[model samples]
Target: MGGTNDAADGTYALRAVDPLIGELLAGLPALLLVGPRAVGKTTTAHRFARSELRLDYPPTAQAVAVDPDAVLRELDEPVLIDEWQVAPAVLGAVKRAVDQAPHPGRFLVTGSVRGDLDSPTWPGTGRLVRVNMYGLTVAELLGRAPREPFLDRVAAQGVEHLPTPLERPDLRGYVELALRSGFPEAALELPADLRERWLDSYLDQLLTRDLAMIGGQRDPDRVRRYLEALALHTAGVVEHQAVFRAADLSRATADAYDHLLRNLLVAEAVPAWHSSRLKRLVRTPKRYLIEPALVASVLRLDTNSILQDALLLGRLLDTFVMAQLRAELPLCRSRPRLFHLRQADGRREIDLIAELSGRRTVAIEVKAGAPGTGDARHLAWLRDELGDEFVGGVILHTGQLAYSLGDRLTAAPISTLWA
Candidate 1:
C-alpha cells in the first residue's frame, strides 16, 4: 500500500516481530492500533510515522485546552499521536483533517484503551480503521532466524491447517513466551525482578491514571485487590456478584469498577456465542486479561507457580488461548468473534467458539497440559446436539505435539498459534 521503507523510522529497525505491520500500515484512512499498555503501540506507531511532532510544553489540562486544529496544522504529514486517549478530544480534529485532505496514510493513532470504552463512543469512527497489537509472537521472538517450524507449516499449508500436525518442541521459545509475557520491554529482557517492577508500576499507573478516567474513586489498594480478583478468575464467565463479594463492595460499586478496569485496558469480558434463542445457553459472558502477563503478575505466579497451581494453570491456559485467537484473527484477514458455548442438557460446553465468515465454526477447549479425548467429547456432543451448526473442534493444550484425538477433533500446542 504505502511505498515508505521500513527505515522511515529507526524504531522499526529494532522491531523484529509483527509480520502484519506492513499490511496494517497501509490499510485505511486512519489506523487505530489498540491494545493493552506496554504492548508497543506507541513504539510501533512512531516507527510507522517515521517522525514525531514533539510538544515543547505539555498542555496543562485536557478540558479548556488549546484548539488542536491550529496546532495540528503546524505538524508534518503522517502525524503519530502517542497516547491519543489521554486527550481524545484531539481525535475528532484529526478525523476532520483526514476527511478534508483524503490521504490514504496520513495519521497514526494509538491508544491503550478505547477512548470511549466507558461511554461506548469512539470519537474517530469512519475516519480510521482499527487494528489490534498484542504481545510478541513466536515469529517476532525468532526475529530474522530462519523461519521457525510452525511458520514453515503456515507457509506450506496455509493457516487453515494450523492444527493439522505438529513436529518439534522448541522449549526455549516456550520459556521465553511464558517468562516474557507479551510486553515488548519484558519480552526483550530476561530478569524476573526487573519484570516484576515493570508490571507493578504498569498496574499502578493503570489504576491511577486510566482507572480514574472511567469513574473509579475507591482507594488504590482496594482497586488493586479488585484487579487481582479479576486476574485469578481470568477467562471465566463473569460473575459481577463474585467481584463485589471479593472486594466487599456494593453491586453498583463492583459494576463501576468493572467498567473502569475495562476502560483502563486492564481486563475485558468476552460474550457467549448464542445467535439463536437457546434459553439454556449462558447469557452471562466470560472475562479475560487484556494481556496474559497481568494475570501472572497479579497472582504472583511465574512459570513454576503457574504449573504448580492447578486452578491457576487452567485460567492461564484460557487466557493464552484468548490472546492467540485475538492476535491470529487479524493475520488471517478475518475478524473472528470468540465466545463460549453451552447447551441445555448440561451435556455440552465449548471453551472457545471461533465463528468465521459464512458461519464457519471452530470449537476449542483449553487445558493445562496434554488433553484427552474427553476434552473433545463435549465438542462432539455439541456437534451432535447442534446438528450441522457445529464444525470441527480443537483442544489447545501445553503439550509439545499436535495430533488428532479422534476424527472430528485435534490437539495443538498453545505455542503453535503464537501470533
Candidate 2:
C-alpha cells in the first residue's frame, strides 16, 4: 500500500519516451494530439514548439476566435496550440495556412476536448493529421520504452526469443499501480485526496463544459449512474439494453453518452474480432474505462477494498492489461487493431485479439494471477482456429516469467506490455 505518482523531470519531454509520436512530428505537417486532460499533452508539445496558445485560457481563446488568421500568422512555425478544439474556427485557419504553404512540421495542436459536431468549422480533413496520446504506459513511465523493446518483438517475431525479466508485483502491488494511475500529473505526486477531487472535477467538467462544448448534454446524476453501471460491465461483453437498464436511461440517451465518452477517449470499446467463418462469435463489443484508475475511482475502490473483492479485482486487472495494450500498440512499428472475442454460445472467450497487418493476428488472454496451461485453453483454441493466420498467442499475467506454452504460444508477464 505504499507508492506515489511522482514522475521523473525528464518525462515532460514526450520524445524522451514516446518516440513514435516524436518521429511522426518530424514528418506530419500538423499533428493534433488528443487525450483526456492532465495526461501531459500540453506539457510535452510545449517542449518542441517555439510558442504556445493555450485556448483553454479564456482570453487566449477569445483572441484566436476574434482573428484566427492573425493569430496563425503571428505564431512561429511548429506553433503549439493547446486545446484547439475550444476555438473550432482556428482549425479552418490552420487548414488555410497549411494549404497556402504545404510544409512539414507546421503546427502542433493538443486537445483535451473535441469541438461541437454542428459547429461550422472545417475539420481540416486531408491537411491535418490527428494522433491520440494516452497516459504513460508502465514502460514509458519507468523510462524503459527505448531500452526494453519486447512489444516490438511480439509484433515482429511472435514469441521467438524470450523477453527480459520483469518485476512481478503481488496483489497489493497491482492494486497500488492502479491507484497510482497513468495520468502524467497524477503520476507526479498528486496527493490521494486531491486525485479524488480532481476526478470529481474532471467528471463534472465533462458533463457541464466538455459535452456542451461539443453540442451534447446529459443529466449529471444519470451519467454518474450510467458510469457506475458501466463499471460493473467493464472488461466483458454486455448489451446496450443492459447498460441502459442499469442506468435507468433511455437507449438513445445511453448510446449518446457512450459515444461522447468514446470521443473524449475516456471509454475504450474493443470490437469483437471476427472472420467470415466465425459468424457464430458474438458481435457485441466490450467497453472498458480507458484507464484502470478511472475504473477503480468510478467504483470507489481503494487498496483495501479492492484486495477484498477478487471478482472486481480480476475484472479491473483485465482493464489494466487492455489499457496498457491500447497505449503500447501505437508505439509498435506495426501497429495492430485491438479487439475482444467471445463465442455467441458462451463456450469460450479471448480477452484481447490484435489484428495486425498482412492478416496476421496476436491473441492475448489477460489473467490476474500466474497462469497454468489450463488457463491458456481459450488461447490455444484460438491458435488452432486461426491456424497460420494466428501469429502468436500469450496468456499475459502478473507473473515474472515469459515461457512457451507450445505451438507459438507464450505465457508472458503483463509487464512486457511496456517493459
Candidate 3:
C-alpha cells in the first residue's frame, strides 16, 4: 500500500479506494479507474503497475492504433495503460488476451473520459471491472484509512454512538475548505490565485478539448453559461426551465449538455427516494457537481461571498457533505444506496438518505448553523412514518459537539464525517 504522505508532491494521495483497487486487481483480469481529469487516476495506477504503456503519447498511441494485439503482447505483465481511450481498439486486444489466459492482475487501465459512452459495443463487458474514483475526501487528506459509511453505521448502531471530532471548523472555515476543493493540487498545494487559475484552466480544457474528444460539438461559451447555471443550482432539485432561460439555451441543447456533463463524470444526480408505502412524493433527482470546488470555481465564489449568503452557503455545504459520503460508499460493508426525499407539496424533506439492506434507512439533514432540536423535525416525521425501517436520523451541523434531539434522532457536528 502507498504511504499516507503520498501527496507530498501534489500529484498523488493515498486514496480510500486504493485498498479496494488492490484487492480487486488480485482476482480480476483488468481494472479500469474512471474519474475527472487530474484526479490522480494515473498516479494510483502506477503503484501496482510493473510496466506502462502511455496511450496519450503519440508514438505509443499510433503504434497501438495499427496493431494493438502485437503491441500489447510485447509489454510485461500487470501493464498500466494510461489514457487508454486514445486507442479504443486496445480494449479489444485486452479482451482477447484475458480470454486466452483468464489470469488475475493482467492490466490496469485509467481513463479521464468514459470510452463506453460512445462505443457501439463495449469490449469490456465482463473482462474489465470499472471502478468509480472521486476527488480526495477530508478523511483521505487527513491520512486516515477508508471510512466505514457513517450513515450505515448509524443505521445499525443508533446516533448516540456518534464520536466527537478532535478538530472543529467554524462556519467560515468550512466555507474555505469547500472552496479549497478535493483535487489534490487545488486542495493541498496551490495558493489562492494559482488555485483559481488552475481550476479555470481545468474548465477550459473540459469545455474545448475534452468535449471534442468525446464527440461533443457545442459552443464553448454556451457550455460555460450552462455550467454556470448548474453551479448556481448545485445540490438542489433542478428547475430545468429556469436554468435554460438563465443560460439562454433551448430545452434540447440544455438536455444534451446535461447528458454530456454526466457522461464525463463531472456531475451527478441523486435520485429521489420513493416507495409504494408512501404517496405524493417528489421524484425529481437533486443535481450536484461532483465536487464543491467545481461549483465555487464556476460561480467565482470566495469565502466572504459564501459566508455572507446563508442560502448559498447551505447549498454548498450540502454539496460538500454529499461528496464525503459518496467517497465513503465503496468502503461500506452494506453498500447502501443514497437518495434525497421530498414531498410533492413541499411539506417535508430530507437532505440525504442512505437506504441499507432490507429497505431500512438512515435519514440526514444538513444545517449551516449550530443545530437545535428544531432542525430534526423532518427527520422525526420520517422516523414516525417508516418506524422500524427507519433506523435513525441525524442533523449534521457546523457545531462542535454531538447530542440527541429526540427519539431516534441526533444532532452531530459535520466534522464527524471525517472523524
lDDT of 2 by residue, 1-419 (tens): 11213346543423333565567778878888777777777777776688888787899999999999898898787889888878888888888888888878889888876655334555667776767677777766676555434455777778745584567677678777777777766665578888766666666776667666654555767777878878888887989899889889899888888877777778867898888757589989998888888877788778888878887888888888876767655556666788889999999998888888788888888777778878878888888877889888888787778888888888877766665
- Residue by residue across 182-266, what tens digits does model 1's lDDT show? 6766655537778777877777777786666556466777778788888878877756788678777778767777877776666
Candidate 1 Cα errors over 4 Å, as ranges = 1-27, 54-64, 117-122, 144-176, 275-279, 344-346, 386-389
Taking the tens digit of each residue's C-alpha lDDT, what string does model 3 give over 285-314?
898999898888898888888888888899
Alpha carbon lDDT at 51, candidate 2: 81
lDDT of all predictions: 0.65, 0.75, 0.84
The better candidate by lDDT, 2 or 3, is: 3
Which window of 10 residues has the lowest lDDT sum in candidate 2?
1-10
User: Judged by TM-score, which candidate is best?
Assistant: 3
lDDT of 3 at 208: 90
